[model samples]
Target: MSVPPENLHPRSRLVHDALRAAGILGEIVVLPDAASTAALAAAALGIEVGAIANSLVFWSDDEPLLVMTSGAHRVDTAALAERLGRGRISRASVEQVREATGQAIGGVAPTGHPAPIVTVVDEDLAAFDQIWAAGGTPHTVFPLTYDELVRLTGGTVAKVD
Candidate 1:
């Protein structure tokens, strides 16, 4: 049996609420071990790594940019910067990540932030029928479709490779 959403951790509960408000009913799954990385999450769920949606936080022009990239691929910052017409794209610091996302580095979800953040969804993620993303914590995750992800984050879909 699954635990009630109210019984989840505060962070995860917020995420659950956010997802629920967005019409997403996927139950958040908690792993015995920390699934901080996409590879670990995929292995724990017995899914292909490519199907994991890695939520990477980046900073460009002092703004938070969330990139939902495929786990199997790395975001080419330089190329992505050019494509997005941003000046240099750099990884956000741990403090910055937490401030912008209200979650740790290894477990930042697409939504559930203090404010609406600018997001970009990788085109490669659309290849998978289902994509698993962090659920506001290192040990929790939830599944959703590409369209759902795009709609949830209101992210612009682009090639991130």
Candidate 2:
């Protein structure tokens, strides 16, 4: 059974409100189980794993970088840093993830953070007409198109892997 937006976790409600404010028509779908991983989310949604937009937070010179990568690919931090003209990119600590996104690692949404994060949307995700993204909680997700995601997060489109 899917949980309605009004019944969502507080964090998920924040994401729902953000989506509405942005004029996105999609509603958050709460999974029966926590879909923390892309594979898990794909299986739950009955969609291709590539359609899952994994929200990853990285540390670039002490700044937080949010990379929305396709589930079908693995992000190469070194290559990404070189492509972005950055020195190094490392996975953010759990604390940093929470502080930066105001959500847990496995449930970070592209928007609805305490502040705007520097985000990069994977170019490969544009191949999909619709994509699923985390909804501020492990058990919640939402759908949107690639263009909508880029606009929502104000992210740069790049080949993340």
Candidate 3:
């Protein structure tokens, strides 16, 4: 038999409240920590990988850049830097991520960051009717439409991946 989720984590609860406050009405799905990856999440939810919105954080010089990429593609950091006219683009460290977004590695949602970080949404993600995203916790995720995500996050839709 499958195990039920333990939905008491502070981070997860914060995500729930944040989403609700943003007028994002959707059910939260909690899984094991190992299921945080897009592939793993899709398999556990029995959904297509393309529907997973992978929240990726990058360091553009000293600033934080959030890129919500589709699960089906890999983000080309060099290409993104070129497009943004930035010095460089690289993956953020755990400390950098936490300091910038007030969230951890596997649970960085589009919103609820400590401050307003520049966010870019991959255009490929627009192909999905609905997408799943991290909910401030590795085991938690929430659903949102592409347009809703853009509105809630104030993110620009671009070809980042």
lDDT of 2 by residue, 1-161 (tens): 55777888999999999999999988899888999999999999999999999999999977999999999999999999999998799999999999999999789999889999999899999999999999998988999999999999999899988
| Candidate 1 per-residue C-alpha lDDT over 1-161 given as tens digits, one digit per residue, 9 for 90 to 100 | 24589888788889999999999999998888999999999999999999999999999988989999999999999999999999999999999999999999899999899999999999999999999999999989999999999999999999999
Model 3 residue 29 CA deviation in Å: 1.5
Clash counts per candidate, in order, are: 0, 0, 0
Best by TM-score: 1
Cα RMSD, each candidate: 0.9, 0.9, 2.9
TM-score versus the correct structure, for each prediction:
0.98, 0.97, 0.89
**Sort by TM-score, top down from the best:** 1, 2, 3
Per-model CA lDDT versus the true structure: 0.94, 0.93, 0.81
Q: Candidate 3: lDDT of 119?
A: 88
Candidate 2 minimal-lDDT segment of 10 residues:
1-10
Over 1-161, each residue of candidate 3 has an lDDT whose tens digit, in order, gives 12122444666666667677888887677676546678987887788998888999999978999999998879999988888788899999999999988888877878777688888898898898989998777777888999988887788888876
User: Which structure is stronger by TM-score: 1 or 2?
Assistant: 1
Question: In model 1, what is the error at residue 136, expressed in angstroms?
Answer: 0.4
Q: Candidate 2's C-alpha lDDT?
A: 0.93
